[model samples]
Target: MAVTQVKVDATEARLAAIPAPDKGAAWIEAARDAARARLREMGLPGRRDEYWKFTRPDSLTAPEAPAAALFEMGEPQVFDGFDRVKLVFVDGVFDADSSDDPALAGVEIERLATAAQTDIHWARETYGILEARGQTPVPRPLAALNTACAGDGVLIRATARAEKPISLIYRHESKTSDAYLHHVIRVESGAELTLLENGPAAARFNKVMEVDIADGGRFNHVRAQGRDHERRAATHIFARLGAEAVFKSFTMTVNGQMTRNECVVEMAGDDAVAHVAGAAMGDGDFHDDDTVFVTHDAERCESRQVFKKVLRGGAVGVFQGKILVKAGAQKTDGYQISQSLLLDGDSQFLAKPELEIYADDVVCSHGSTTGAIDADTLYYLRSRGLPKAEATDLLVLSFLAEAVEEIEDDALRNEVTARLGAWLARRRG
Candidate 1:
């Protein structure tokens, strides 16, 4: 097939206008600068780019580069009011006074920039190396842009075992402007870490986070993407798992103007297991897209993924999940399923589940289904004297119960459920 080219002057111009580089590790700074240069040469993603086809980048054209600011935040509330080690960032700058994580035992929690300055070895090796090995050429623009101007977030290291969970909150307080945030999370060996990532887009925030899980480790990552009506944001996450390592990630996209989430999980060792699941509820003119890629490169690896999307009004939802097993990745077991419910005639959903396997001794299966709410079930509920809106809400909850049930944390589960219920009320009203 012949390759055609399209001009990407806008993307190039936007990248070219970023401010001068600051003092940091010469290598990481250089790597970021190089990526920007490459992006300029490659241009922005277009319809030809399969990964970004459904969610175009044309609408993201900005008149000027985003500025740095100290955004005003709303009344602060604990993420479920948990007594866990916590770190807070408002508009990408760390708030030392706002954070109150009781200095836990057997954990090394420090500011990312502080760690980058004092203990450069650990920070550079974890963030710099993993990103290089996992980055792709297609979505290079986003990563490059983040690298060039990555604000301070958190860098936590769990020494042996953590008695309590380690939580981080990225809050967007400024509603009148756009803010950029970049975060890095790493877990060492023989350690257990639970991360509750809360992205409440008050005004607007564009964020990129990179996480790495070491050998003999377990990481549970939960993300809540709930924002006001005027907010627009995107999150790009890349994670690598070592031998006998486990990663379980759950994401709930309940509200937003435009939200895009992409996760790449690479299983590079034996006996590694990765479970990815998410639920999305969109209303009005919302655009929600969740894309995930799981690659198995070693023997005896397993992965499972399930995503459920509920669409109402003129909302558009997209789900694309792909699993790839390499030639030598024998005994790889992969399973994927995506289901969607279109509540109204004007609403739409697109689900694409794909599998590419080169190993003959592997077991892989994928399935996708798109349908309306079961009329018989709805009638049965209405027959029981329940209002139409209540019946629909019950059915929507029932449809998404499979994914919601996996959340082990009680506080997070209840909070997510409440958010979903609130969305259903607005839709059925």
Candidate 2:
């Protein structure tokens, strides 16, 4: 398929200036070459592009990284009590001194740079492969750019049921850092893995993650985009599921100046299940976007997308989600919902939900809604001897409960909820 031609403006030049990582492995180099070629043909998304109409791409595609002040954190770490293996990244570079041992019992972990030095590795075939596959129906030039130029990331393979989750923690100290990270995860047949990510990586961050779940494999991901109001990020996730495999991911974001999270999933085997959900809260010049695409190509596959955003004080939230059931994908079940809660008249929410089905035996549904807190509910809460601000907070939490509930892990859900509560408290104060 031919890539749609767009004008080569400053953004295109900026992308061209970025150097691609030169891995020693032949296959890795080949993948980067292919990605660079595709990116050149596609170019950066312009304001004219329909997909970028809601949010301007200028800030994300600029030649120089935006200046962002480092946030002085006062609260304890979100996953402080959790038992997990932690990998740390400082200013987008893997910090071996601060990270735990990469080697886990049932999982093999290698830094992308280290793995690339070997002539042959398991990641040779999977790295950037899924991202390349996802470009067909929709062109994700930013993701392709990350695949081509990302400086650091990880390659993880789960060979058996992992006893503990793997956590990625990012820390930012540079005021003008531009960080690009790419991760590859492969879950062997019957294996299970849980992955966790937290932090604001840098001033301007571009990230891509590709996951492959083998037959009967299970993968779970939970992430919290840190509360850095000056940060800007564009992240993408590409996943493929095999027969009876299960994939679930949930994200919680707060207070970034701009953030775009894109997820693409393909069910390539019968009876696979995939779910993606996010809960975001933005206030005062903040912008958040969630774009998701799920494709069903096998019989009896199921997929769900649930996203909710809370906007206040001139903040903006956008959601674009789609579910596609291909021909011969019989008995496919798909559902999608995107909702937003606006606290004031100045805040705005924009949503586009779609479903395309070629199979006659498929069941698909999509819905989008944006509104203020229910007057009746708020009145009831206020009448119960609660202050107006407290009552409003209650209603806001109620509105976000559905999406937060989508997190399958109880501990992670609680942590997310606590963080939301804290944010609400701060806003009210």
Candidate 3:
């Protein structure tokens, strides 16, 4: 559980040299300054950092140059069923040419930078709000580095009971460069909103997303992160729920040199509910990590988490999930499950499921399983005259079907399934 103090000390010293924020762009400057100040206070996570024990952060060393704000944006491929609205970011900058929102009634979707300048209420409530939650002493510098330099993100505020879904896409065309992005989402009370966020390949791209839901609101988020073979990416999503608020999240990860998706959901208000499902497919030298931390801080909250991973070649997969119930969180119900399939001897998987309970009246359970293809089942299928490879592929699809089914949008689910097939084929070859 010991940490590398040398790296932590070096990172803190580097952050201390950054100059203060300029008077102009005060909010962004403030955010960056806050990040630097917090850097000295935070260190890389150690083995003792229970939340990050599985996914080691010491491997990620900060790049030399600071993240840039100006970069060329390329034409983005639009989704067919996403007629509600679209906002695109390329190389961490908002691209106007690729954004579209149906001029519908009773809805408002805008950019975070513009909102910061004009809308006081919106800016005050959500702008750079993720930092207020504070940071733990995780050895990973991406979180702090992301806070230090992040571009504006798309903001959506659907009024009470939204009628349509909202979609946002961020593309990284900088095949040889690195980028960082930050996004904040706020859903008002009694409203219903669906969102899709996509990312392209880059040498490196780190993203942090914070979503806040008011009482009686419903937010359904679907995230897809697919980058090039040599690219590295990490995403952190934190959601805070209010009384009677409902949050459903579905994540699909495929094709990355090294990618990790970390989700933290807090039921801070009574009667809140959260449902989360995620799927990751890794091939070649790719590494995909999906971790979840759900906390029940109020009474009568319910949550369910399901994660599935498929690995091939020398690929590696990791899943760490935990559910915690506070002292007064009576009647809390939380469940978590993680499953993985290693197709070859070179493939590997690490899974950890933990539960921390302080309240006497709560229900929580977690389970994890990591194993190779079931030989008995495979033999049965091969005995029926199916080829070995074909039988394995079929079994893989069947194993991953549960997580894919969680995607309520069938079209999107099919698209992700196609991507999964492509990744598997490459590994087989």
Per residue, candidate 3 scores C-alpha lDDT tens digits across 248-296 of 8988777677777777788999999998888887788778888777889
Query: Model 3, poorest ten-residue lDDT window?
Result: 65-74
Whole-model lDDT for model 1 versus the true structure?
0.71
Ranking under lDDT, best-scoring first?
2, 3, 1
Q: Which stretches of candidate 2 lie over 4 Å from their true place?
A: 1-6, 9-12, 19-23
Give me the candidate number with maximum TM-score.
Answer: 2
lDDT of 1 by residue, 1-429 (tens): 222344366665555554433456655566566656655655655555777767765544353523323333344443556667777776566777777753878777776555545534466666534444555523545555655556455677766677777777766655335455566667778787787777553344556666777887888887877645545666677778888888888888876667777778889888888888898887887788888888899888889888898888888888888898988989999999888888899888877788989999999999888889899999999999999889989999888877776677787777677767766776566
Query: How does residue 207 of candidate 1 score in lDDT?
Result: 62
lDDT of 1 at 304: 85
TM of each candidate vs. truth: 0.89, 0.97, 0.86
| Model 1 misplaced regions, further than 4 Å | 1-8, 16-21, 61-78, 201-204, 426-429
If both were scored by TM-score, which would come out higher, candidate 2 or candidate 3?
2
Once model 2 is optimally superposed onto the true structure by TM-score, how far is the C-alpha of residue 324 displaced, in angstroms?
0.7
TM-score of 2: 0.97
**Poorest 10 consecutive residues by lDDT, candidate 1:** 65-74
